[model samples]
Target: MVNGPAGRPARSLTQTLPDGVRRTTLPSGLRVITEAIPTTRSAALGVWVGIGSRDEAPAMSGASHFLEHLLFKGTHKRTALQISAEIEAVGGETNAFTTKEYTCYYARVLDSDLPLAVDVLVDAVADSILDPADVETERGVILEEIAMHEDEPGDEVHDVFAEAIYGNHPLGRLISGTPESVTPMTRTQINNFYRKRYKAPEIVIAAAGNLDHATVVRLVRKALAGTPLDTGAAGPAQPRAGDKRVRVQKPHTVVLHRDTEQAHIVLGGVGLSRYDDRRFALGVLNNILGGGMSSRLFQEIREKRGLAYSVYSYAAQYADSGLFGVYAGCAPGKAGEVLDLIRQELERVASSGITAEELVRGKGMVKGSYVLGLEDTGSRMSRLAKSELLHGHLMSVDELLGRVDAVTIADVEKVAGDLLAHRHSLAVVGPFDEGAFPPG
Candidate 1:
């Protein structure tokens, strides 16, 4: 598949990292990454495409998610049921999901069934038919899915908050576009998106669990030999680029009045990008602030005052922007007190920073979760793919733990002052009017 000068064998272009993980690029611009976990009997494989909602035009908002469904509907050589049956017959599973930055169709099977896994997953991604009748059938299913999501006030308010924060940017829209946008989306538009974005240059096949890198490569090469997917000359796509700044006019409030018992609130402001070095410090700050039961928010709001049962904070990082938010569930009448305490705690941290004891606790919690989570082959596969997709390099476990260890108390203070010192916005879902909101 190499595209060098005529008549010579094309040497592989690859980089093998620590932990025996390997990243290889085919001549056709397809990238493949794999990890061999000797103790595991099963293998997990994913075909990741680099197009998601952020890549869509305004009119094409939900196309990436829609294509996720269509790929499983059928392919040129296999019916939809047959496609799934093959995997299930081997005691395997197949599923897919779409996110803001990418889409993945993945499978888990016995290591002996890897060739079948590669063949089926590649066929689904590279050879789907996108039948007209199947498109129409899936339209109703997706509409009902939207209706299902909207019915849950807690779930829907996050989208409302995103719209409030991001305004008209594609990042502001729901992953499942509005009923209007998706209802009338046609097959021709979907086919065009698939043909254009689902190319070898933007695809990665990642595998973990018991496996061989050379054999996996050989299987993938034989799988697409004569197809239109055979690329003449191209390289992998560059990471998505856009600096759509969050344009909030001071602090704001977006309240959806659903007749619910507890107010679901998300409060805070813009924070770090995925590439920022300070993210390690930010993680520590999030932990001390509201990441666990022993965290400040959980201890103060839920345990001491009994104001809420679920109270926490989180950070969401993207290619060029991110969001940091604190979430709590409480009664409508107590919303004011909750917001005031939140503000007071943030002011305290912004002014004096967290104590040294808190830093050690935060580091311990982060390390525990990090190490335990990576014990799964699926988790390893995802990490390997995402590192290659976003950063174009792999960070070892030792390196990750070291980064967390390096976060100092002063680092926390400076980051707290920089991110949490500003006037922040609020989003609420409950039976409350604008007049009921707490002071900003």
Candidate 2:
């Protein structure tokens, strides 16, 4: 048996994978997973590291995002301009983003250019210079980004809602971080955080489209040679455990006063974790409640009453905790009415549940979105990486659809009752005082 995290037993490196997909774990503990799609002439490759904003301490809040920018600035092998110019010369694209749980640097190019993409991305991620000058420049850019984010009330309300739910928890903090955190964070702090946290065992390399899995693995191995990721033997890190519960603050109303044209509001509460079996049921409920224009919220708030231009329900799941929220952007005068209607509908669904027709329609929406999203190489590559990095196993597309199809009306009702039972926290961003919204 291979050594896992903390000396626990881990899966063998040569386990069987689904059709068109393959996985290999290197002696250095880096994982390479791939999907071969012969019909397309393009390929998408992603280097996914299992570290993000949530992994940071308060002093190092934006370090993950800052490191993302610095990685692209320059590596020992290539300058920043050469990095972009090389990819663009072949009509390809490369970019990276950091989320709450992980950071991904990806490139999409013709299948013939896969080698170039692999070399560039791996070199950048595994051997960045992290120059002090580049760090200072990125610091200014990140501060401006934080300011620009505050200007968008539609977006800011979601952050407010998260803050209301999680309070001072890491999940509630901004991914870009605040001006205070970004300005004071020194290069040494960030570099130390990067070297300490970005472990080979905690990384996954995924590629898809018109390629052979063996060839992709070979390319990645060659690219990683002599890099920081090339190290002693170890098994891949295990996925984050789900048993540890996240501590949350009590529900309350939080209003950010901004003189905006539309009032942005979110009403929500605690939700199911990603590992929960009832998540399938929650997915169905979300689609029915606000998945599309045909959803209950859209039909009631926008089409029927003309109360809001946008209204939707969303669910976000993490390893141990999650959030369920309903967002509506409406005129300031109509905010109260819109919020009451949302509460009424939620209560109605909770008490009575949805009908048979709604259940079928919800299931169809979930299945169609999942399948259609995989039509491109990027999504497929992302699926491979996320399954390995986040879930620790890749469920076949058919298996996922089957799981959704098995959800019955009873399952939906049970989840709805459980999720909606708690008092919802409110977050409002508009021209309003702190007490404009009542306490939950």
Candidate 3:
């Protein structure tokens, strides 16, 4: 048996995993996790790295995302065009994305083409040349991307909300660095960051659909051979440290003026971490409030009052911090009334808790979405990676559904009171000055 995080014994190789799922840890400390779905013709694979925007220093802001773009530029053995041509030759697609806490490069291809997918992806990630010319090219592209983001206020307000909560913390910074930060960044700096941070122990390779776990492991090992990732024996990296509390700024209002047709507002505050036992309860609460058309926020804000065309509630959880927010897009003139209505509903839920009937519907919504989301290979592959990389273990679909089913009305009330009753920070974007919305 191998040691797991915190020096505990992990599941032995002989131990039974969830149905059709298997895992192996290489001597280099990289993990390969897979789920076999015999009925599908296509397979999905992802290389998940533990590092993300939150891992970068203020000066290195957006390094993770910048590196993501650079990796596709070329590698030691394959030209950029050759890389795309090889994948496209097989009618496959590939892409990568950066999140606050991790980054993933993935591809979906026919099961027979998984070997090609594995080789090309691993080569790009492990042996990228980081050409100086490519860096300058992507820098300009990223700057233009940042400029374009400002044109969409509905999307920009969420980032503004995060900033309102975390202030200058790394978590608050944009995943794509600002023009000021990207323009001056050097290729040498990026190359150094990539070599130092992308270690074997902090990476997980996951694949799903119409494949064998053993074969996937073999492919990964072959693909990694002689690359920077092929290191001497080690154990998988310990999960991110979650014992320390993440400090958040005091609740306040932050507004960005934009001459837009609609106002976008996000109101919320600090919430339970992903590790909290109360997260299941919080999930149920979120669904009951605004998960679907039948949700309370949709009914009250849009159906009953016709105050907004779009309204919803969401919770974002990280290793040691989280936030729960309600979002609405409406006419600029109706911003104040919409905000008040959101506040009133939050107060009511926190005070009286959800009823038994609401609790049942909420649980159903949570379970349904979770199951329906996994119907595709990409989602299944992601689930395997997230469980291993983020949560430290794989939880079966049944176990997850059970957790949601176990939430009691009192549990919902407890999480509601703990999260919603706190002072909230507001972020608004559209036709308004900074002081348009006063602090609560």
Give the TM-scores of the predictions, in the order they appear. 0.96, 0.97, 0.97
Question: Candidate 1 at 307: error in angstroms?
Answer: 1.4
Candidate 2 vs candidate 3: the lDDT winner is: 2
Model 3 / residue 261 / CA error / Å: 0.8
TM-score of 2: 0.97
The per-model lDDT (C-alpha) reads 0.86, 0.92, 0.91
Candidate 1 error regions (>4 Å): 1-3, 6-11, 242-250
* Sequence-dependent TM-score of model 3: 0.97
Q: Give the 10-residue window scoring lowest on summed lDDT in candidate 1.
A: 241-250
RMSD of each: 1.8, 2.6, 3.0
lDDT of 1 by residue, 125-227 (tens): 8889999999999998888989998778777877777776777787788888878789889999999999988888888899999999988988888877765
Off by over 4 Å in 2: 1-15
Score residue 168 of candidate 1 by CA lDDT: 76
Write the residue-wise lDDT of candidate 3 on 204-308 in tens digits.
999999998889888998999899998866788877777888889999999999999999999999877888999999999999998989899999999999999
lDDT of 2 by residue, 323-437 (tens): 9999999999999999999998898899999999999999999999999999999999999999999999999999999999999999999999998866899999999999998
lDDT accuracy of residue 147 in candidate 1? 93
